[model samples]
Target: MTRALILFAHGARAATWAAPFERLRELTQARVPGVPVSLAFLELMEPRLPERVAELAAQGVTAVTVVPVFLGQGGHLLRDLPLIVEQLRLDHPGMAISVSGAVGEDPSVLAAMTDFCVAQL
Candidate 1:
């Protein structure tokens, strides 16, 4: 059961915002240890979700899980992500794919974000 993890982020025009996501991918890899991980963007940034999915498929991954990095169940997650996932499903009919909830809406994540904001002021 080969599995791959795709970390999807809302793309940024500045490019610098992507650096943190790269760091995040590294951290996730370290934590998970065995699951193959990679980063993908919704827009602006390169290597869109479909492309990442293709890459994972090429690497012989039989299943892939997509993790959205957004803060809420916004239009991107509710509409765009499912569209992308459906497309990928068609494109990779042999591979099993699943999309997880947005990371930002997690309780621990919201608390951490609030802590960071409060500490700054």
Candidate 2:
């Protein structure tokens, strides 16, 4: 299957917040050479989830793994994401989609946050 990564970020009203996401996407794409990576916002931003998904489909992506770039399981992750996934599933029943857990829950991520916090203190 042609697999791709979809980084799901909670959108910010401040335009500057998007820079980090684009940077992260660039880094991730570099690390995973062949697979295409795209960013989708939950709110307050353009190219929302559906649009991003559509773009992926246009690229002939057979499977997409959605990684939520969140700190915790909050409303957007807990509730909204699933709804969007369901909508996509219905819209493209044949497409294979995998929803990965929040990246913040990863052990390495926690460790990195701790390291940053300690450095700040």
Candidate 3:
């Protein structure tokens, strides 16, 4: 079963907002050499989550893990993501899709952010 990792983020109107996400994707891709690591946005972006997942599905990826790059669980995460995932499930029944909590919610991520903040002083 071919598996892929998708760093899902809320896209912004400004193109520069995607720079960090792109970097994260590249870093992740390097770590998982054979596995596919990609970035997909929720809106105001070129490749929306559904579209990216479809592309992966077409490429014979049987499983995908979606990691939300958002700082917190807001409306987009609480409302929009579930609906999208539901539709994706129906659209690609053969594929297994699972979603992790927002990156900001992770303890390690929070610790890292805290360290960065402390260093700013």
Candidate 4:
């Protein structure tokens, strides 16, 4: 089955805020190879999650895994994301869509972040 990974992030007004996320998409795409990896923002940005997923669904991507890049499971993650997912599911009846936990909460990711913080000490 065709699959895609969407790295979802909270968009900011400053263009520089997107630099790291773009680098992340590039790095992830290089590592996964073949499976398309893309970046989508929630707000204050272009190509929101729905638009990106629509493009993927149209491209015949049967399954999509969305990784939230947010650091905390706040209102946007706890409330808005689920509503968005539900709507997207209805919008793309055939495609399998799944949302993963916030990247900052992943054990490995948290450890890495801790390392970076420790290094600053």
Candidate 5:
């Protein structure tokens, strides 16, 4: 089964808000050439989670892992995301969809950020 990775982010009204996420997507896609990678936003952006997943499903992706590109376990991640995932589950019963912890909360990420913070001093 074909597998894909989706980097999920909270979109903003500003177009520039997506640039970072797009760059992240590109970086991840380069690292994992075997599995396709894409980005989807929670709101105020194109290709919302469902649409992106549906497109992937149409392209024959059997499994997908969603990694929230957020800093903390905010309402979007804790509340909104689960509801969206549940809908996706119901919408695509055959697909295996799973979610991982927020990127900002990851140990490695936090370490990097901490180093960056120290450097700024």
Candidate 6:
């Protein structure tokens, strides 16, 4: 089964806010050569989660792993995401969809951010 990774983030009105996410997608895509890696926004951006997932499903991707790039488990993660995922599941029943925790909650990511902050001192 073909699998893909979708880096999910809360989009901003400023177009430049997506630069980092786009870069993250590129870096991730490079790590997993064959697996499709993409970026999807929550709002104020194009290719929302459902749209991206549908594209993947159309491409015959049977599995999708969504990684929320948010900094914490806020309302967006607590409520919005579940609802969106529910619809995505219904929309693409043949595809297996799973979601990972917020990237900021990961110890490794937190450590990296800590390191950057420390360097600033």
TM per prediction: 0.94, 0.96, 0.97, 0.97, 0.97, 0.98
TM-score for candidate 5 = 0.97
- Summarize candidate 3's per-residue lDDT along 1-121 as a digit string, tens digits: 9999999999999999999999999988999999999999999997999999999999999999999999999999999999999999999999999999999999998999999999999
RMSD of each: 1.0, 0.9, 0.7, 0.8, 0.7, 0.6
Across residues 7-119, which tens digit of lDDT does each residue of candidate 5 receive? 99999999988888999999999999999999999999988999999999999999999999999998999999999999999999999999999999999999999999999
Task: Name every residue pair that clashes in candidate 6.
Answer: none
lDDT of 5 at 92: 99
Q: How close is candidate 1 to the true structure, as a TM-score?
A: 0.94
- Total clashing residue pairs per candidate? 0, 0, 0, 0, 0, 0
Residue-level lDDT of model 6, residues 1-121, one tens digit each, is 9999999999999999999999999999989999989999999998899999989998999999999999999999999999999999998899999999999999999999999999998
C-alpha positional error of residue 100 in candidate 4 after TM-score superposition, expressed in Å: 0.6
Candidate 1 Cα outliers beyond 4 Å, as residue runs? none
Per-residue lDDT of model 2, residues 15-102, tens digit only: 9999988999999999999999889999999889889888888878889999998989999998999999999999877679899999
lDDT of 3 at 55: 100
lDDT of each: 0.92, 0.91, 0.96, 0.96, 0.96, 0.96
In candidate 6, stretches whose alpha carbon ends up further than 4 angstroms from where it belongs are: none
Ranking by TM-score: 6, 5, 3, 4, 2, 1
Pick the winner on TM-score between candidates 2 and 4: 4
